[model samples]
Target: MFTGIIQAVGRVAAIERRGGDARLHIAGLPLADGKLGESIAVSGVCLTAVAFTPDGFVADVSAETLACTTLGDWTVGQAVNLERALAVGDRLGGHIVSGHVDGAGEVLSRRPDGRSERFTLRAPPALARYIAAKGSITVDGVSLTVNTVSGAEFGVNIVPHTLAHTSLDGLRAGGRVNLEVDLLARYLERLLLRADGGGVNLDLLAENGFLKQ
Candidate 1:
């Protein structure tokens, strides 16, 4: 598990394709404290550190992960967001992130919002229902709040500190990103489904005291 707080911006040192899977050698992140088989969040994907390198680590990307995320599109020298797995006592600076990309999204627009940048992205249709205004969403491993939601599209504001520390600074209108919806939203949907054959409704919210009586 992770907190979606990026620790470092690493680069794809090399990629070795073997059959349907690929092994990635990532550089520029300190791996001294990490050991072999440790879990690391590589741009919203939980990848195992199978081996350690002088400056970074190596991880194997499965075919399924490639097909589901932007990792498959990564080229040599591409910048990637990196975060070590959360320790037991670490502060939860960001919302809970499973490092499992739910689906990919495309940036529809990026406009300046004062010193910050406002990004509008379109999530996969199936994943859109889990997103909500003021809810947390992980984009390329960075946790952000949904400022607005319109159908499958949502908006987020990236502050200057976030831009300077993460790989999202290079984002453009057509760029694709890995997206993970809020974890609570997923479980809440399941609970609602189990409570009734139908999904969330006004009656359910009222019964649960989520709405005024």
Candidate 2:
């Protein structure tokens, strides 16, 4: 789990392919307190730290993750957003982010809005239904609120501070990004489906001790 608050900006120092999977060595991300096998959110995808390097860390990217996110397009020296896993007592600065990329999205446009940058992105059609106006969405591991929605297209404003602290500043029109919808939104959709006679109703929930009978 993560809060979607980027802790550091890193770069893909090296990439090594192993069959269908790939191993990435990241540089410039602070990991003095991280341990081996720890979970880290690398551009909205959860990757396990397999080794520690003098500069950064190494993580293995599975084939499924590559198919679902923009990580496969990464190359050496590519800037990336990095966020450590949320600790038990840490403050939830951003919304709950599972680092599970539902699908990839494309940057449609970018325009200056005062000190901020307004970006419009098009989400995957299958995941568009989960996006809502004012709802939180994680883009490339950075949590942002949807300003408006039109079908699969949504707009978000990135403040100057965010741009300076994360890798979002490098994005341009036509760029692809990893996207994760809000966690609660996923559960709400499931409950609504069950309510609409999906057969997984409250009776089943009670039977499984998920709710009081």
Candidate 3:
């Protein structure tokens, strides 16, 4: 698991296609203690390091990952948010991020908000139900709080620090981003699902204010 805090902004050094899959070599990651077979969050998608060098490492991306994320569109020198897996006793700086992209979203718009910037993004129809106002969501591997929700869209404020530290600085309208909704929300939906109608009901959730209307 990852904490969704970006440790470094690495660049795609090379991409070698192998049939439907591809191998990626990333540079600029400060992974001094990194080892082969270690999991790393590469722009919100957990990828394993198959080879390692002082300045970089290599990982394989499957065809499914390519179809689900922006990794397929990556090119040499493309900046990517990088984070090592959370270690024992490490501080949970941000919300728990599984580094599993649930779906991809499109940047709807971006505008200034004081020293920060407010970005609105449109989530996939299937993933929209998992997003909530004030809930945590990972966008392009950066964990952010949703300030507002409107149907399939939500807005988040990106502080200057986050903008400078990650690749989100390059975000623009019409751009696509990898999104991972809160893990709790995903599990909650599963808990409510039932084939025998024996699971928790909306009335119970509504009594606790979990559901509106």
Candidate 4:
């Protein structure tokens, strides 16, 4: 698991196609402590490091990942958000992120708001229901709070620090980004799925002391 906190901004060094799959060579991130087979969150996608390089590491990207994310469209020298997996006792600076890209979202607009930038993005129609105002969402591996939600579109404010540290500063209208909805929200929806015609509800919450009596 990851905390959706970007530790470094890495660049794509090379992409080698192997039939339908591809091997990505990333650079500009310290990988001395990383071992082969360890997971790394690259732009919201959990990829296993298969080999180490002097600066970064190499990971194989499957066809499914290529089709579901912007990685396929990545070009050499493109900056990407990078985050190592969360340690056992590390501080949870950001929300829990699985590094699993649920789907891609498109940048609808980006405008300045004081010292920050407000971004409005359109999530995939199937994933829009999982987004809520004030809820947490991960875009391209950076966890952000939802400032507003309207249908498939949502807004987020990126402070100057975040903009300077991560690759999100390079976003523009019509750009695509990997998106992972809140982990809890996804699980909550699963819990509400009833196999026997009854599942979690207000009455169940009250009975279980999750609601005011």
Question: Which candidate's TM-score is highest?
Answer: 4
True lDDT of residue 143, candidate 3: 89
- The CA lDDT of each predicted structure is 0.95, 0.93, 0.93, 0.94
Q: Indicate whether candidate 2 or candidate 4 has the larger lDDT.
A: 4
Off by over 4 Å in 4: 197-213
Per-model TM values vs. the true structure: 0.93, 0.91, 0.93, 0.94
lDDT of 3 at 201: 76
RMSD of each: 2.4, 3.6, 3.5, 1.9
Model 1 regions more than 4 Å off: 199-213
Clashes of 1: 0
Task: Give lDDT tens digits, candidate 3, residues 1-213.
Answer: 998999999999999999999999999885778888999998999999999867889999999999999898889999999999999999999999999999889999999999999999999999999999999999988989999999999999999999999999999999999999999999988877776876787776786799997
* Model 2 CA deviation exceeding 4 Å by range: 195-213
